[model samples]
Target: MKKIYFLIALFCTVLLHSQERYFLNSDTRLYTSPNTSSAFLGYFRYGAEVRLLSESQNGWYKVQADNFNEGYIQEKFAATRLNAKDVKIKDAENPILEGGDAYYGGNHLFVLVAGLKARALPDKNSKIKEILFTGDPVAVDYVPVNEDDWVNINGNFDEEYARYTLRKFIGLRPNFETLIKDFDNLDVNAVSERKTLSERIVELAWNSEYSKLEPAYQRYYEVVKQINDPKLIAETEMNMALAKGLAKHKLPEQIIAFTKKAEFSLKGTKTKSLYLSQTELVKTFGKPAKKANVGDECGIYLSDLFYYYPDLEVSVDEKKNQAEIVKVYINENNKFIINPNTILDNSVSEKAFIEKYGTYIEASLKSPHNYSIIMEDSQFRLVFKDGKLFSVEIFFYC
Candidate 1:
């Protein structure tokens, strides 16, 4: 029995030593399972350490905060080393927190930089009490103080009084999760009202939410103008122009010109529609539901083949071995989508179409009340009947 007890003690020690330690980079809640909707076990502040009990799966990890606290956490919020200090904060010129008279009557401030140093006193040379990280909320009282560059941190930093750099904290935290949720719902008003324009722009630019791209770009443009920063203005204008052009399905040459001048890439912008080959079309739409050889109207083509899919029709010129015309039929249940903002459906109106695609090169009357419009550069043709768009055709000019 003595030998068994000694072996059990040795095994427990080995298990404890084998557990890998991870430091939280962002304040994260411990969940009962690897899901956000699950009941929370506890909340761990940034800079807190946890033992990795299980490997990461589906962006979550089973971690143990202490002997009594074992739960799951998001893998992105934790790192192998306590190196939140390494994450650089952009736009350092405009520090989120300002010193002196800028202090408002707020009870808490969020840490902007990871691994922010908290000292025992207001001086930099004072002994360090603890390190705060990004997103960590520090409680404070906004009483008048003579120190212009330092602020007293209250109970949030381990119960002991500490001093942190005044400019490192922000009155309002960037709520990226709420922004993302609002963006998904296309709540333009809510998204536009979110603070932290620069940070929000970065997140929205990286997202593939095409339906709200134009609105978001417009909002960014409005907000950026207020900033009066030349670099930011140029960037926002370029991005907004790209978003507008993409929504309108501008010519490939025009798109290339816009992209060349822009500093960043739009998430899902593609210029391949102007010169779609048979292989590319096949790859995009899979096998067509029907195919047939049709008489060629243009003398340049030897034969024309019509390929029909759910709500799309492709006219392939056999001699050139390229798709000459692509027609999209819009209906209530159509799955055809040109972009996030441009969906081929009955919901699109003639005015809306013109607004989305930009100015047309020429407009001709097909009949007494029907009209056929050719877009700029003659790459697209739109047919309208009774002031409503019927079909949109992509014309691949040789």
Candidate 2:
């Protein structure tokens, strides 16, 4: 008799534990520690359902909500307005919305926003019935899947191809088939063999150049397919976030810092810095380094390889213990002028040589010519012309 009673009690306990509750409010907040400011776990809208997982001693119950798991909520807030039977829908039928775009709930469609709104009754004209204000939200009654505007929705729903401008949204609905294929093709052990596919996807998106955001989007998609590293993904997504104007602060300095460390680049290789010629400087370290005008006039040729900025003009003059740099003209205008002194040195160090020429070479103090450094760094190359600094090649490694 005791065994029989134990079996009945276990079955009843399991049955009693299987219950769910639907959210009544339009927005439900999930707190990290049953209090605000802990961390936001995501939010749910009206009619969203959750399966009860566990209960806290202090009136807080843990629940498994959509995407979010182990969420805490006060039992007093457990009051739901949705009827139990209405929470779940039959797979055979789905609710449809009547606006340009609509989101589906349990048994209804909710219009997320109203912009150039339209409506179509079953077997009626496709023309819009009425327009709606920008911020208005309305419920959708039926979906017009068979209609012309709704075709290929699951396949192509980008904002550029969207039927209504206001209906477009960021991110696509999760495609199970594509996600499965992505996971299946991934090789956890080797990634170099799969680089071609990722490159192709990224190249195609970049070549389009339709929108400013397309490049970042392509980079993120390729990152998702090629690399499973969460840190890399997070870094790429941060770039995407900045590209989309989602970042609140100015990132110019951060971007410059990030670019300085990049070893490889999709673009050409070049390092930006001002290079001064010894023949052009009249002074060196508290004394005249070289003659500024040996014969007639001082000639300065300013060449911009990548043309990133305008030409900067600097005047040359001899000073005691150093060279004086003053901007005497700009863009053919002799206007701007400021004097700045730079330390003069005769000896070249390995680090300083690389900083100037992008490489280090055996520094030779050749007679007549003070020094000639053969660059070992791969980013720059220089050719001497007429015993002066000739063509300086800069490579920008992205």
lDDT leader: 1
Q: Considering summed lDDT, which 10 consecutive residues are worst modelled in model 2?
A: 263-272
Candidate 2 lDDT by residue in tens digits, 30-57: 5556764566454434444454555444
**Model-by-model lDDT, in order?**
0.52, 0.34
* Every model's TM-score: 0.26, 0.22
lDDT of 2: 0.34
Per-residue C-alpha lDDT of model 1 across residues 186-261, encoded as one tens digit per residue: 5435434543543453333333233344665665565567666897786566455445544555455554343232
Which segments of candidate 1 are over 4 A away from where they belong?
Answer: 1-271, 300-303, 317-322, 331-346, 353-361, 364-379, 385-387, 394-398
Instruction: Report lDDT (Cα) of residue 203, candidate 1.
Output: 36
TM-score of candidate 1 on Cα atoms, chains taken together: 0.26
